[model samples]
Target: MPIYVQMARCCWIICFLVFSSLFRAYEASPGDSDQLYRACLSQCQKTSCVGARCFSCCNSASDGSPLDASWYNIKHLYFWWNHWDCQSNCRYHCMLYRENERAELGLEPVKYHGKWLSRRQYGFQEPISVAISALNLVMHFHGWRSFSNLIYYSLPLKPDKTPFYDYAGLFNIYGLLAMNAWFWSAAFHFREMDLTEKLEFSSFVALLGYSIILAIIRSFSLRTDAARVMVAAPIVAFATTHILFLCNYKMDYEWNTKVCIGMGIAQVASWSIWCGATEHPCRWKLRMVVVGGIFGVVVKMLDFPPYQGLVNSEVVLNASNIPLTYMWWNFIKDDAEFRTVNLLKKVR
Candidate 1:
């Protein structure tokens, strides 16, 4: 071959080899550090080989350089960005380096650093936390004072005896009245408030009031059309309103709203049966056997885990905790324990 031709062929072969090697390196998986380093070097060399036609090629190429100091710096930066520690280090490094660079260039870094900073003097507590705390307090009070024992249960009739009012029955009636009073008080308090306040107050009070009343009545009566009306009205009303509110606001506190509604409905059903039976003792045994059993099952169902998901809120509790906490004091009694036990026996 001619001397010039031979030299040109040799150059072409060298170029081909270099291009192929770089291509292979770029295609290598980044899982292995050694492989990644090699790939970076290959990419840098390939870029440099192409010359300055590629603007910003110098920075890109420098990333792969094999020089110990250059490689170490690039590797450190890569790890910093990819690892879990990046979140903490990123802000610090960006600020420090950007600041130093800006100072050197006689330019000011932007005032808004893109980092989250607290502007408000106060931090808000979560609603769920507040709710849990309130629940704990109520549970504690109920436990210590035996407030939960105030339920009513009836006995089957005996041939020579007449039905009589039991302590449980009396407590149940009183408990209903007290719950109703508190509920109405809250409703009035929030009557002039904003949408959020209205929703919170209305939802809570409605649920609680309706449930307690139902429980009171059921402990005394049996199934009847009147009982059904009383039991269903508040539940349907609350559920309808709650759904409307949710549709408008997409609030996360809807759980409590739903729970309240469900409990209200359950209590009404339970109480109506109880009351219905009380109103007609001749048919009471039969009516209680059917309606009473079903009502008991329904109330138990309301206490299940699925129902709990509806009302378990930290945010609601937190927001309403102080008021609820204070309100609970009003429900406390010196004789709460005795009353509660009596009430529980009646209900049972």
Candidate 2:
């Protein structure tokens, strides 16, 4: 076999190992299993009690009847969902506590929207996830400003002189796509609506695939308009096709996961190898970025079943990933500026 083929095979093996190790370590530690229940009970003790139990305020049956008898009556009564902004999570947990107590007395577990309340988040809405998404959107918008300034003022005005200028449009598009993706991410986590979920997933996949294309184009120094378009067109088509397949036809979780993982590996690997091979000043920074990116992926994958705490998966993963990418982007831009300056000096 050719050495290049062997090297390519080795890179794939390493990526597979990285993902497998992350998958294996994706267990959430439910430390002190009764801590949340105790906390809920403590809060309940502070409120005015109807008999021995706290008043049904946030997520309980309104008829003041026993859950065992009126299970159907309040099964769908999610006060937290109705008044998400106003309802406290304490009240939600209190409702869960009540359900647990009732179940011990032979009452069946209650279902809301065809899902058992146990699987539902502590509250009807995921405030943490929403907040993280908002923060990520803000970061992306701020990066947009920085990126705009870098592209417009930092790059040479004469496109005939440098290859980096041809990429301005692609970078700008990437920023817009990132912001759009985060917007839908926040919306989906806020409401978990079907449409929002599809939008978020599609937008993010588009951003990921586009990032890979951008990395390849810039890394190889493909500055000509024709070369840039040739490389980007196929990637854009694939991303758009995948999004349409997901949103219009079937939202296949398994396929989505596979494609996303592939793109993520390609993205990190491309940049890492390019930075290593190039004479860029911030080459070493890419090493840190790739490591952080992998850890971020692990953090994202750890989000799983039994999401029953103040900490949310969406929040954690976004917080972990966004800053790393943000810094990585700045490093990339700096490297481009470095190259652009040298190119201008040579022309002068």
Predictions in order: lDDT: 0.38, 0.64
* Residue pairs that clash (backbone atoms under 3 angstroms), model 2: none
Q: Could you give candidate 1's per-residue lDDT for residues 167-261 as a string of tens digits?
A: 33334444454444334334322221245344554544554554444444434333466865764575457556654655465442334333443
Candidate 2: stretches off by over 4 Å: 1-124, 154-156, 159-166, 301-307, 310-314
Clashes of 1: 35
Q: Which segments of model 1 are wrong by more than 4 Å?
A: 1-124, 127-132, 135-145, 148-225, 247-348
Per-residue lDDT value at 158 in model 1: 23
* Residue-level error in angstroms, candidate 2, position 2: 14
Q: Backbone collision count in every prediction?
A: 35, 0
